[model samples]
Target: MRLGAIADDVTGACDLAGRVAEAGLPTTVLLPAPPAPGHPSPTTEHHEDVFAGGDDASACAVVALKVRTAPVGQAVDEATAAAQLLLDAGASLLYQKYCSTFDSTPAGNIGPIADALVALAGADGTVGTPATPGARRTQYEGILFADGVPLAESPMRDHPLTPMRDSSVVRLLAAQTAAPVSLVPWEAVQRGAAEVASAIGAGHTLVDALTEGDLDVIAAAILSAPRPVVAAGGAGVGTALARAAVAASGQRVDISRSQLPEVPVTGRLLLAGSASAATRAQTAAFAGERHTLDPLALATDDRALDRLRDALAARADHREPVLIGSAPEVARAQAELGAERAAALIEGALAELAAFAVHELGYSHLLVAGGETSGAVTARLGVQRLLVGQQVAPGVPWAVARSGEREIALLLKSGNFGGPGLFTDAWEVAP
Candidate 1:
């Protein structure tokens, strides 16, 4: 079947599948979780048992498994068993999950897995991560015993997992591989659909292997005619990718009999500090409204209250979106705003909903601009699992989880992450 498997953290798996699909291979992604909410208890029980079985049919049939818990030795043991089972089932290809904390170096993780896979397959095998260059060197030294190949992806260039992606293990794999290791450039796909088309036009075969978020971008790419589309990754990205592929290819996108997720987004955001001028400008530009969140007014002076109120009022008047900037600063500001003031803002926004409009007010989307503020707002709200972006950096590290009735989207940024036009790149197409 010329099949491939991707095993990594949840986000890495989804990102990798998106790249692999661009590279042109039929793929499947298997996550540890079941998709349906309140699904049959037996389904969850069966999945866990499948791993405990450590057999080939179970392993070969399985494409990807996300290990959320740490001390990864146990996860590795389970993976080894599954690999053995898959080999017994006549499977030749396999991939393992790699994390920075466990291996300390990419090769530390990749080498042993490759050696094991080679021993089992009696042939070469692939191991990879979206880690980084220095770590890749360390991985190369560790992989002395086996023929290792590294698969690299671009979307994760600045990702927290960079340590794993750029490790020596990946570089060595890329150098040794017969063909150029698949390069899934984040910039190419960030434009959503057109990049997929461009990749196929550039001679790559498209595989529909996304399993998170919406498939709107992927669907647009498939419609452009990338051949042999295969769906895999997080259940959300996978299902959406499969549906899109089916609609495009006029055939069903075969799915593994694994449980998947129903909703596309999960996680939360934490904002801290006052909004930066650049952030307000960017938000205003993106939302097609005038800048309202005044950082100067909110931070340097004691008028944060008035500034926040004014910002909210402006949003109400123009129906423009409001994005809180910073997390740490917001936390500090919270002391001044007090529980009563903070709750009033949130409660006021919520009140604007149809039923509460007379007595309450609310926002369509609460975008906390800064990571620190995000944390403060979430804590004040007494909610956990809110979407959070990594400490303000290059690409916003978005973590989405369910929060009551709200689907929070946090866009984290720092003064140094970029200047006024940083996010403009997100909207640009790769030339």
Candidate 2:
């Protein structure tokens, strides 16, 4: 693998992988076990088999890690281990993927992990940007925005996991690391890559970007370097790099877009585990049977799992689509079950629901929302490998996975992805 990426969440990992694949590079998205502490080498006996399948040195390989919201110490160690595994796998280029909204608290895995990776690679410095305009997310003048509204004033302000109360990307990044931070405005980005890289070579930077063009310029500068650059950003940056490689090679690059198999879309189950305002809007507008998971019930009810079964059964009987989600009130959930336990409970419930639906009930397709939720459900279902297929919708693909003797198709969606009607439209047109 020439290019290796470490994403902080499962859904984000898939998105990052897809962006590179779309740029005509064969790709593999793997969930690897970080090497154990005191055992730095992946060849150690203590570590689980990591990156077992995809080892094509010419391809783009991504290792998905779930430390986006982990404690600082644990996140740093895990990220360092993951970096070593990719480096061992022959990846000369390393990119750390985070959310397009630049979601993270002042004390974070973002800044600290970037510092760790930069030091590990012995690179000049790291670059950070969360500007993915295709996802309707961008950063300008050090501030993050969704559509036209500032992130702090947007739906992300109420994010259940990492409530982004701050919009200044530079300030947000600076608070998390002692590294010297600088901001390159959009004008400098438009001035082209060399200037932008000159600014980044001095120290870590928050590059201003409002459109895909900005990313293209940034990618050109980053890739033009005499040696490999240690970079971290959203999926857009990865996409830019892949496309730049295609252009520089001066040959037709083979982009492996997933193709939908001739399978029917029956026995499909949709799990909405995100509490973002965008997710709430999409779930509410979904024209189907909806079962909102009660946080109070999941945290305290003795028969909560049974209740979930009953709700799913009723929906299954009607052959109507289903949406099971905890309400978007993160504060209520935090107060009721605590953030850590609350997320674990919700994800655990969704995982069980999905396993029963797919393994016991013989369901064939599953549409899941939320990065953490997707990670949990995929783990519970024993999905060790995935074959990325053509998207059912934008950023939502029909991916094939195996769970024992069963082959299941899953569509994993991040909380802030897709339009309000994305769910209904996906079901109406999928395999």
lDDT against the true structure, per candidate, is 0.34, 0.76
RMSD of each: 14.9, 3.3
- List ranges where model 2 is wrong by over 4 Å: 33-58, 226-228, 250-266, 313-320, 328-330, 428-431
User: What TM-score does prediction 2 earn?
Assistant: 0.89
The estimated TM-scores of all candidates read: 0.33, 0.89
Q: Judging by TM-score against the true structure, name the best candidate.
A: 2
Q: Give the range of the ten consecutive residues with the poorest summed lDDT in model 1.
A: 138-147
Candidate number with greatest lDDT: 2
lDDT per residue for candidate 2 within 1-431, as digits (tens), equals 26778888888878877667667765666765334578542222322333344433235666666788988887777778778877876777889888888889888789998888888888866775888887888888999888789999998886767888999988998898888888989999988888887777545777888888899988877776655568779888888888877777764344333354545545877899888766778888988777777767777787988888876666636245677787667668788778878888888899999988877767777889999999888878866555555554445655676777877777788887878887787766455
lDDT of 1 at 92: 35
